[model samples]
Target: MAVIIKHNELEYAAKESAISEFALLTGKKQSGAEKHMKYDIRMLEAGRFSFPYHFHRNSEELFVILSGCAVLRTPTEFFEVHEGDVIFFEMGPDGAHQLYNHTAEPCRYLDLRTVSGLDVCEYPDSGKINILPEQEVYQTGDQVDYYQGEAQVRDKWPESVLEKSR
Candidate 1:
């Protein structure tokens, strides 16, 4: 019953970034909408950072750029993708990937993802990890935090040792 008519659906804009054509107007009632799992379609404008770079442990994703151009970074390498191009990221075990619009013109794309039970995602840059509850990204911070060695005194052996080891 959750079907979106492409022609009837309005472009969704991103609230955080003005460079996007996705606002609240076209947002679906459900956060994750897809049969067999959660899926969403987003048409982004030019000069937008699609989303944060993260890896899904159990979910697979596909990015189809309909217009303009962007760059997709996988664990193994980076690729320059343009309109009519599609990128498939299999579930699990790849160096978490990211997509960005480095071009001056607007880039429109469709993002499709499927949920395979439970999953965890890692954000390499900010050192953040998200344990997805259903289809939501839960910011749980670093389960393991690293400490600086030189700043600690002698009694802080475990902490100091950990720092020194690094």
Candidate 2:
């Protein structure tokens, strides 16, 4: 079976935060695409921003400008992208990017991502790391050694088990 979603039938859901706000219409999931990729159409309101300046450790992304213009900020430069423009972001620090709808009108684009099993997204400006699916965000500077919390593990064993082992 094939799923065909008409442009006129797109249902947009609003998402808002302090710095970013956009209306998103999810497409890949509705099309029964499960593993390799995911995609959504986003309408970014004027004066609003997209996700923060971040990049993925395991996944790559692409953005296709659908209707309006926006300023794209990458690690080394900032430039304008208009309708019909396509942008590709690789995995890692070099791919760090953010977008802002600077025009008076709204800007719409297609956000496509490669769905690798898990992804770790790093925010350079905020020094934070986000784990996808789990949706957990943590400070990058708060990392600890692998065995940092493993001390006194033997104390957790039962007395009967200890005696049996002895």
Candidate 3:
């Protein structure tokens, strides 16, 4: 079966932040979509940005410009994208991106991504990583070595326990 939804039918909700004012189409809820991927439509007002510069560790994402124009910032470059443009972002630091609507009118784009049980997102500018599903945010520099807290074990099993098994 196929799911069909018109853009006009999408319910938009305001998402306010320090750097942007936008509306988001909650596709998962609207379509009752689950499993492989998730979709969202982000509508950004002129001079507003979509989100912070960040990259995912577990999933890739694709963006398609639905209307108007915007400036897209990747780790190494900035691109002026217009309607019908499609962009793919791989999972990594190299894929970090931010989209800003610099045109005088609003811009809309589809944000699609793979669904993952766990996702780690890195925010380079903030020196933080967001662990999803658990929704924990931690400073990148605060990592502890893997075995840092393990207690030293001198023997594989205690003598009394081993004797009882024998």
Candidate 4:
């Protein structure tokens, strides 16, 4: 079934940080979309950023500016974005981005992304990779060697098992 929702009908939550303040539309809760790609609206306050510079390993994202203006920062460049602008971000480091609204008024944009069972999000500025759903954050330098926690087995198989197989 197609879902129809008014902008005002969606609940909004405020996310505040030292460098940013924004309202995010709670689309999943309102529309009951679980498996499908998610869509939410972010209304960023003036002089605030939408999010940190980051990229997703398993999901793609797109943004549509509904109103106002902001500066979009990518891995190598910063560009001005305004109303009616459509932006697509592919999965991985090349797609890393952040948006800052420098205008006096609010900047509204639709945040859309593919649904993934698990996602690894890298925050370059913080040197952290966030494993979503499980919600674990680890610094890039914190990576441990594989099998670091596993108990070592001296032999490939037990003698009894090998005899039985023979």
CA RMSD of all predictions: 9.2, 2.7, 3.2, 3.0
Clashes found in each candidate (C-alpha, N, C closer than 3 A):
8, 0, 0, 0
- Please tell me which model should have the higher lDDT, number 1 or number 3: 3
lDDT per residue for candidate 3 within 4-78, as digits (tens), equals: 767877767776445435333333235565678887877877877777789999989999999999999998899
Of candidates 2 and 1, the better by lDDT: 2
TM-score (all chains, Cα) for each model: 0.64, 0.84, 0.83, 0.83
lDDT of 4 by residue, 18-107 (tens): 542533333334566548688787787777777778999999999999889999999999999999999999999999999988889888
Report the CA-based lDDT of candidate 3 relative to the real structure. 0.82
Q: All models: lDDT? A: 0.64, 0.84, 0.82, 0.82
- Candidate 1 lands at a TM-score of 0.64
Please identify which of the two predictions, 1 or 4, would achieve the higher lDDT against the true structure.
4
* lDDT (Cα, tens digit) per residue for candidate 1, span 1-166: 5555463454464546463532212234343445465545565445556557778777788877777787887777888998899887876657477777677776666677776666777776666666776445445562435554545565656776778877
**Highest lDDT among the candidates is held by which one?**
2
User: Residue 9 lDDT in model 4?
Assistant: 65
lDDT of 2 by residue, 1-166 (tens): 7767676677777654543353333432356654698778888878878887899999999999999999999999999999999999999999999988888997888898998788999999999999996989999999889999799888999888889987
Error of 3 at 61 (Å): 0.3
Angstrom error of the Cα, residue 137, model 3: value is: 1.2
Q: Return the candidate ranking by TM-score, descending.
A: 2, 3, 4, 1
Alpha carbon lDDT at 159, candidate 3? 86
Top-down lDDT ranking: 2, 4, 3, 1
